[model samples]
Target: MKLLFLACLSPKTGNYTTAERIRSHIESAGHSCELRDVADFHSPSDLAHLVSQNPPFEGALAIHLFKAGRLLLDLRLPFGVIFGGTDINEDVKDEQKRVVMEQVLLKARFAVAFTEKLKEEAEFVLVSPDSKIYVQPQGIQTEVAEQFCWTEFLRSSEWHSKNLHNILIIIGPKVDPALTAEVEAVVKRATGVFLAQERSQQELHAAMKRCYAVVNSSVSEGMSAAILEAMDLRVPVLARNIPGNAAVVKHGVTGLLFSSPQEFVHQSQRLLSDQELRERVVRSGKLYVEEHHSVKQERETYQRLVDKLHKAQFLA
Candidate 1:
């Protein structure tokens, strides 16, 4: 079967990485899968033109429900959805987007969420009994470039400080220019806080491998691919105490969680000073990733789902 996969293929973002992984999984199952960046299409007519120009795709899949699913509505092709964090957590707050998302869910053959909590959130939007949502955690795999020089990376980013032992890197979405400048100014005043600019996946993994700890301070998440990747790379994580982060980081066990700025400071101090605790968390965190977020398992799950989708499409 030929499949069409739509996603926001922005470089260095989680959605692009997830779409790539799933596309590989589908192709590995002996199917032809073509991935297209949804950013290229302005409307359903654009997608319709592509479909008409090429051989018809037997099935379709998308990462974000509202962003990508809206384009699938008029295609009249069997398609599934994978939840992008902001669509359920942030975008649904708008009544118009929520209504459109509801229609997309009702029309979709199936949907996928990264965590059970996210799946439950999706269920609330998809109240119809026939709507099926699967809970599939993001898979973890890390490859650190051997020649990646930590000192060179720091220098390139304009951090000339020789004291690199306790460097704390902040990784998050890009904000407005004014807000970003304000944040960068504050970070510059601090001793060792490094604000990461956009980097390729290989560079990001190398940076994660070298950092003292990976910190996630996002206001919301579906399930953080960064946290999982950090754990997989055997780096201790300090994440915000949100449901999505909490679902992965068992406080003081796998990693540390902070609800407030003071808590984050306290936890960071504890993680740095207490060598035993740091070692224990790093060990356990890597183990958890190996067991729960292995690439093999994620691929198998998608392959099974694709087969099921094929069967359903055949019967219909």
Candidate 2:
């Protein structure tokens, strides 16, 4: 089936990466998939024109509910909507977007949430008894180059001069002002903590390998690719103890979760001093990623969705 995969195709962003991975799986299954940037279309007519040219496209898969799925509303296509982090975390709180998202959810043949907690929250808001929300964690794979020099990376980062356990904070281009200030304060108040932002995926992976622990400071998330990548690379994680983060990082098990800046600072020290704790979490983290977020599992899930959608479209 020829399919349109609508998502924010910004390079290295979470939505783009997730859409790309799903698109790859669909294409690998011998289905033709067109990945279009949600940002590119201005209106339903713009999208309608694009789909018209393709002629007889089976369906579409939209990445974010309120953002990307909004445009697909009038397309009259049997589409599936995938929830991005901010959609369930922030947009559901906005009255206007929340109303539109509920309509989108109603129209969607099925919707996806990264965790069961996220699905529960979405279900509460949509209040649909027969909602087709599914929990599917992101598929992840990690590999550090054989010649990756941790010491050299530290020296270049100027983190080597400070005798501290370097912590990498993964951030994107446009961060919330409040979140930015909070992360900055954490870096300043803590002596050894360092910020590693604005790096390429490969660069970030190398940094993840060298850093003592990776930190996720986001107030909201669907499922953090960075956290998964860190776990895949056997790096211990310190993340905000929100439902999404908690869903992935089990406190003192897979990784450490902190409620406040004070807790984060305290845990940072613990992560540095407690060798046994660090080793156990790192080992458990690797195992968790291997078992939960495998490429094979992700591919199979998408394949099943594709088949399901095709069958639905054929019957319709």
Candidate 3:
């Protein structure tokens, strides 16, 4: 079968990771898969022209409901959608996008949400059949570089030894500007907290090893890859207590959860001062990722989803 996969393939985003991973599994299953960045197509007509090639695709898969799913609305082939953070968290608040997303859900043969909470939010928009909306956590695998010396990296960057115990707040390009501003304000009032922006995945992992604790300040998420990465690296996580963050980090067990800037500061200090707590959370977090978010498991699950789609095609 020939499949068209549409997503925002920005080099550094989670959606890019997801689309590429799914494409790999689909192609490995002996199907032809073509991946196109949604940025390349302006409308459903543009996408239709692309898919209308000689021997057109049998099916399509899109990453974000509002962004990529909207462009595939007019597709004649059976297609599925995977929800991005904004679709359920931010865009659903907008009346127009919510209405359009409802129509998209109705047209879709299946949809995926990273968490049960996300599935619940999507079900409210359109009462799709239970089997259509799947709650699958993102699969993750991580390996810290053998030569990664966090202290050396920090020294080379000229950070003070006094601040060596500082927290690392990773700021990605897609994070909400207002949330970023809010986190920045919190950072200003706190001591020994710094933002680590613009580093590649490997570099970020190395940096995370040296930090006292890593912070995830996103207002929303679709199973944050960063959180999983931190867990895999044995770094204790301190995240904003949003539903997305909460889903990944189990407060007082796997990691600490904070509701406000003040709570975040308190938790960071507590995590730093309490070595027992830190070690316990780090141990539990590593185990959780290994048990639940294995890359192998994720690959197999996606293969199953593709196989399901193909079987339905055959039945039709």
Best by TM-score: 1
Which candidate order results from sorting by lDDT in descending order?
1, 2, 3
Model 2 regions more than 4 Å off:
129-131, 146-197
Tens-digit lDDT track of model 3 for 48-130 = 77788999888888898889889888877778888998888888889889888888888887898888889998888655777
Find the candidate with the highest lDDT and give its number: 1
**TM-score of every prediction relative to native:** 0.91, 0.88, 0.87
Instruction: Write down the TM-score for model 3.
Output: 0.87
For model 1 the local lDDT of residue 30 reads 99
Candidate 1 C-alpha error for residue 61, in Å: 0.3
Model 3 RMSD in Å is 3.2
What is the per-residue lDDT of model 2 for residues 1-316, given as tens digits with 9 covering 90 to 100?
8899888887767666678889999999989999999779977888877887736677889888888999989986788888888888899889999999988998888888888888888888875545588878999987665454444224333453555355344446544578678878876765434554555666668777877788887788889998999999999999999888999999999999998989998999999899999999999999999999889988988888888778778777
Worst 10 residues of 1 by lDDT: 151-160
How should the candidates be ordered by TM-score, best one leading? 1, 2, 3
Q: List pairs with backbone clashes in candidate 3.
A: none
Q: lDDT by residue for model 1 over 1-316, one digit each (tens)? A: 8888999987768887888988999999899999999989978889986776567777889888899999999886788888888887888899899888888888888888888888887777655443488888898888887666655335433343655565666755574588788898998787666666777787788878888898899888988989988998999999999988998999998999999999999999999899999999999999999988989989998888888768766876
Clashing residue pairs in all predictions, respectively, total 0, 0, 0
